[model samples]
Target: MISAYACGPGDEPEAAAGWAFALAASTFCDVVVVTRRRFEGAISSALAARPELAQSLRVIYLDRHPALVALKRGQAGIYWYYVLWQRSLRRLVSRLHEQLPFDVVHHVTFANDWLPCGLVGATSAPLVWGPVGGASASPVRLARWLGVRGSITELVREAITRPLRRLWGDRAAREASVVVAQNHDVARRFAPVTAHAVVEANASILSDDLAAGAASSAAPNLVGPRRAVFVGRLISWKGARIAIAAMADLQDWTFDIYGEGYDRGYLERQVRRLGITDRVRFRGHRPRTEVLAALAEADALVFPSMHDQAGWVAAEASALGCPVVCLPFGGPPVLADVNAHVVSLERDLPAALARTVAALPRGRGERSHRWDAGRLPRFLEQTYDRACATSAVAEERPGRRRVPRPARAQRR
Candidate 1:
């Protein structure tokens, strides 16, 4: 497993996904995980807590070049460092493969499809890329809702990343044995590249947590107006402002905004401008445990994010049996429970949100759905088995192009 940005105890989505996937993979097979040096302490501590699991896992930490390390000060620097890291990883994996000659090489982190997976071409082992994404762009029609600066930033980002997307698509199609897209939009992007792709929600929630959340939902405790909570970074794309805008007409309901980002000041000002500061609370950033606790108490998870590949909170909210109100588009629809509300963005968002909020049940109810963490390991194992089988057939066929396997059937 090559996961450059894998986290150990970190709360970042990428880190959590990497850590959970790596741990899960270790349970099924002897796994070699390559990650950055920064997570060494956390990884060591976590492994120490599970000595039996550690016996089957080998972790290798790779440090970036000093020049690249200094580049962490800016976004460009971080990207450049990632590019350098990929180059370094190719060399590292080539050497590792010579010794171990592993069955598969899975690229797990920096899940964006725009970034090329270095280990794919470096090793003959069947390569699995993703649950990868980054194809979704903020809807141009919703530009005004994002404000002037936010709109420009989104546009600029699209322009700069266009070339990278092309390169990534071409590389993934030619080299990746399996491409796991996080949502339909991303799957469409890779359609031109290769048919060997599948849509799987990347977020992984523990079965125990889901059980606890489900149990919590059966009991109701409410005294005041129903509360709607918004989790995720406070960015225009995350639709925090949209939630605030929606709150203007929802005078009977209180809203809480968690997580912090560059959009904090703008969102704060919008709250003041709307004169609903008293009804809304900016709780800032909180630990994952605390965030889950907050979701348990809330009546609904108001996730208005426009382009999220898969918001983990939506799954968490569903597991807790908390109602979720999200945009009909993107990854949220896939993760949200069947009973959760999905407001259409074709008309006025605030009006749609208002209607959705008004229609939501005032009291807590059992979650109709919950994420099954057990499925992750099974699904990944199935994917690995498929990749290996396909790779063997390709080798036997020599020059013939292998037929793309049916994706949905493999999931079962």
Candidate 2:
């Protein structure tokens, strides 16, 4: 059996369903998707809809809170402590091991470093590993900025955590039987450690219907004109305020902000203070289905998030034939061929908005094709098989490391 361990409550139902469907359709394995207590309802309903996965894959909820988890572990600095916890994630797996008979455990994020500690040095059932990567900054630089601590504190924290991360993380990842990476960018980062690193493209939806929608240039033609939509939380890193500020003069375009978080009150005040209240609106946390329908009708999706593993909103917009304007690096590189306008964060965003406004008249075609349900499932099937066969102890080649055997390709 194969089990999946995910951190936090994943709200991207389509994405999660795609993963579970892929595993169930192709392999003899059963998938157990684990998440925090908060996300159970959203994730469970999403998975239940999939006929193939309804019986095979199960959802497991944990009471693991990030802040509380950190405190209980007595970690000094939250960010560095996160890294250490990531290094020691094996404890989580041991708990998971008791619930299911799984030969492989796929931990969803790099934040859960505890995973490696469980399987690192052990010579037992093979472990397939993948760590989220390709962030805006180097990990070391990011650590320094997390707290207001002086250079000495930063140095002390780094001194302790960096070596431990290297020692523990390297052992777990390097020792893994296979590592599945989301992109070439992520794969290269882990190249030195795992010999059997394979790149897997995230699956998205693109179809004839979405293409037709783009061709029609059919955003909900509101009587007074529908405002530009921002579909994320109200946080400094999320760049909602930046978007609101940039749109002050685009009176013709209203801004509807969605999602709920601690930053809502602060952001609302920012909107009011800017005197763009009529132009900016907050819808606050709509259901996923409603959000998708809203995206289909919106003129554009704006997000200037400072750092994200991958901008999921970009993918959603592509699926709905909605154009996106974001800080250049916020979205994935694959969208370069389709409906994305990458902007530079360092310069004036107003200039970027002008360019985005200029491009709105021309509707971009949907970039993603409707995902064939069997596509990822088939790919994973072969990946699991080949990795299992090449169970030889991994060796490094001086130049380009040897490519593992290609899994049978699926025709899109």
Regions of model 1 farther than 4 Å from truth: 207-223, 368-370, 398-412
lDDT of 1 by residue, 1-412 (tens): 5554665656567777888778777767778888888889888888888888766678898868667686677767667777778888889998987777777788888887787777867777788888888888888888877888888888888887778888865687557778888888888888877758888877877766655544444344466677889999887889888888989999888898998998999989999999999999999998667677778878888988888888888888887777888986678877876646888776688888878987887777566444565667778888888888777777678677553322222121
What TM-score fits each model?
0.90, 0.65
Candidate 2: where is the Cα deviation over 4 Å?
6-105, 109-117, 131-169, 182-185, 195-226, 249-251, 330-337, 370-374, 393-412
The residue-by-residue lDDT of candidate 2 on 165-284, one tens digit each, is 467656656766776655455565567877787755443343443444445544565466545788886655566766777777576777888888656777788788879888888899
lDDT of 1 at 110: 84
CA RMSD of all predictions: 4.2, 7.4
Report the lDDT of model 1 for residue 275: 97
Model-by-model lDDT, in order?
0.78, 0.55
lDDT assessment of candidate 1: 0.78
> What lDDT score goes with residue 273 in model 2?
89
Q: Which one is best on TM-score? A: 1
